[model samples]
Target: MALEWVVLSYAAGAEAVMLLLLTLPGLDGLRKGLVAVTKNTLKPLLSVVPFCLFLLMDIYWKYENRPSCGDEHACTPSEYIRHQKSVMKSQRNALLIAATLLLYWLLFSVTHLVIRQQQLSQRLEKLRNED
Candidate 1:
């Protein structure tokens, strides 16, 4: 579980950095490279969709089987500790799943927009050439 969290954290950080880089000025080369790669091989990235669905299922299972801290005020010290840990773990898992989905959506939308823009540009160039 720790390893999974570490991997996810690194991936999320890398994605955030890439997004920031894409918006910076004087990075047209980097942007074009990303667009080109994405255009050529976007189908592979869609695999993440199923993976995210799995994560969502895991979250649902955890929620359905959550440990109840019956009578919060009356919980013994150990019972309270256990409940707190369980709640924290569940929250972390839910947040990670949400973040992963959001990242996938952002990447997919950006790739689609980039491809559309390229197509429109090509059409405009062809029209200009015919004139």
Candidate 2:
């Protein structure tokens, strides 16, 4: 059981590393091919088969060896509520980070387009003046 948990954790960690690598700018040259491969092969395999396997594993582990609740009668509901609040806060922070990155990328693309258009216009004007 411990070995299975360890292996599953490792697989999840590896998948996370792969995701991070996909996000890096330096890997853009190969990203299209990678995306193709992921879309054609890995995506379906991981999303369907591995996900179901992992879900089953988790359910089995949780059911077979449930964590003991220390003095459940005395357990504070506030603590669970606070934990949920913290999780929500963290999710919000992640969303903010994603939004900021998307905004930066959008601004960069717009600026690049404007610069290219200006250069083209300048070239056209110069040609007209020469003629």
lDDT of 2 at 29: 67
User: Top TM-score: which candidate number?
Assistant: 1
lDDT of 1 by residue, 30-97 (tens): 87887776545446655655765776677688778876766654777898898788778878877886
lDDT of 2 at 24: 64
| Candidate 2 residue 77 C-alpha distance from true site, Å | 1.1
Q: Candidate 2: where are CA atoms >4 Å away?
A: 1-75
lDDT of each: 0.69, 0.50
TM-score for each of the candidates: 0.74, 0.43
Clashing pairs in 2: none
> Which has the greatest lDDT?
1
